[model samples]
Target: MSRAAVPRMLLRGWAIQVKDSSSFGFFIMSSLIEPVIFAAIAAYMFRAGNRPDALLYAAIGAGMLGVWIVTLIGSGQALTFLRHAGILELLIVAPVPFVLVLAPITLAAATVGMYSLAATLVWGWLLFDVPLGVEHPWLLLASVPATVIGLGMLGMLMASVFVLFRHANALTNMLGYPVWLASGFLVPVSLLPDWVRPVSWLLPTTWGAEAIRTSMIGGHPLPAIGACLGLAIGYFALAALTVRHFERLARQRASLALA
Candidate 1:
């Protein structure tokens, strides 16, 4: 694809998403509300006696969790809806690259996720006086593209499964809770069972959360940064391959009604 065409494709995808404001609002609000509630409770509970940093840590956790969950789950559901509507097939037939076809849907989901993070941060600061700082501004800056590519690839991987099984939506929902729990957003990873720690390492959310936490909180160098970045890049590479494989399968399996 031409460099100029990329933005056009993204804009077109975004425009299609914005046309459905009610669904978008519902999707955004649903993801935001629960995290806000949990953050408030965690802040209050952890900050009850002393330790001002407790609220900050709680807010950080909540914000990271909010973005992670919204992007993964929202994008997966959006992709499934688009596929059911036959938009995925239509887009594949378009001149744009397959990856660009998923952009608009992923953008919509990421927008919702970022909005949720902003809301949580604002609410935490205003209500609890939680203070947040970026100790490693450069690292934090690098994380934005890393997160977008990593999570976008994850969403594509999940979406591809729908091509093989109509019931993959159930799988997304099933995996969502466990993925969230494993990411240590609600609790610290150090507290997790030893056996589960290895599994958590395999999840993108874990790396994303760690990166955010390390950047926001000043403690020590983030030992997981290299691992996180490497794993995220690898995951996206695999996701791209999966998208191609599934797109071909989808084309072959399309019937009159499916089309």
Candidate 2:
């Protein structure tokens, strides 16, 4: 994995995904415009007078949610789609690794997500006077990549389920919604019911949001960055196990089908 080869792999992945115009159109609608619209409504409804910090919180929250959408929607759905289309088999036969084959789809989604984040931030600043300067610049940038890797891994895990199951799309959708709600996408975790609070603690998005919030807004410290990092690593590990299990099952099923 030379640095130069990375871009080529990603480019190959990107070229394959854009072959479908419908997917590209849906990507724009779901990944770009929808997030900005939601953020605008949130900024309007939660407008504050002197609480600049709160606005920053809102912006970061909204932005991070956009990023999550890319991983959750794009990676998960693309995997299922490819499998059903029989392209997954072709990709498996390619020279690139499985992860590389998935990279362009995720990256394409991430690009849209970033655009949505930028739109939300601009809208927040212009319409609601939300401050956009980073209080902890390094922490803010570091959290972006970490959060992406963490969520991307989880998406891959969910995508793997599609290999062995007929209704993994529904399962992915079910898993995605609870994470968005419980992880404080539109509301703070503190506002959730007492019993739900504990469940929220178990979600990776909760730690991700906390890390991003702490980084962007100059407020209370998170439990520990290391703890958040550990949680993310654990998530990746679990997803990897799930992927391996499903891959083995897929191979067995294919052999049986041939026989």
Candidate 3:
């Protein structure tokens, strides 16, 4: 494939995955349907507390929760799917390069998260009468894709690492709730324990959530958005290196299975 064809390939691959995954019943339940329940629960809790901004806060947080969950599960299992389907080797040997083939999967995973975000917000507004006021509409719009790209790159890093492990699902299962909590998806980072603060700082979801919330409520979101983009660059570079190493190991082993 020509150099110019790479972007098209990535976009085409991402589009196909978005379509494929959306059609999957489990994906719809996990990414969209279940998250609305979480948001409803949060809304009830906040309504009980009688906090003024409760519904909106719960809605946004719930959306972010869905976004993280979809991206995490989808990216975590991406390479495993390829291996199980017996196409990992063919893609590895293809002239297009494996990283490009893999990246769209992660990106598509993150893209699907957007569905949760939108649905959760709409669900909140329609059901709970949550206000849809925006402090900075443009920033909120920009933050959406920034959040997606950042999470997608982090997913790339995760997928690459998981390629070296046989029980990647265990790690993904372990990480889901903890990452959302740590990322402040449904809580303020400042409210978390001081020791946990450092861990939250290192997560792309942290910056993404913050950027989004700040843009919506009333604050400068640019710094958090910049942080998301910066982390995207770092995560991409690290994932590239990790994938290169995984490819080397796979070449010697001739299989993705653990010895």
Q: Provide the TM-score for each candidate, comma-separated.
A: 0.83, 0.77, 0.95
Candidate 2 on 44-119: residue-level lDDT in tens? 6667444444666677667667666766677677666776566677776666666656656654554455555676
Comparing 1 and 2 by lDDT, which wins? 1
Backbone collisions counted per model: 0, 0, 0
Q: Which pairs of residues have clashing backbones in candidate 1?
A: none
lDDT, candidate 3, at 66: 87
Give the alpha carbon lDDT tens digit for every residue of 30-104 in model 1. Answer: 557877887887787787856556776778677766676677666676556765676665777877767667656
Instruction: Give the root-mean-square deviation of each candidate in angstroms.
Output: 3.2, 4.3, 1.5
RMSD of 2: 4.3
**Residue 154 lDDT (model 1):** 66
lDDT of 1: 0.67
Candidate 2, residue 196: the lDDT equals 78
| Model 1: worst 10 consecutive residues (lDDT sum) | 218-227
1-259 per-residue lDDT for model 3 (tens digits): 8999999999999999999889988778878898899998888888788675678778888888888888988898888978887777778889987789988999999989888878888998898887778899999999988999999999999998986777988998889888888988877778888988989877889999889888988899999999999999999999999988888988887766432
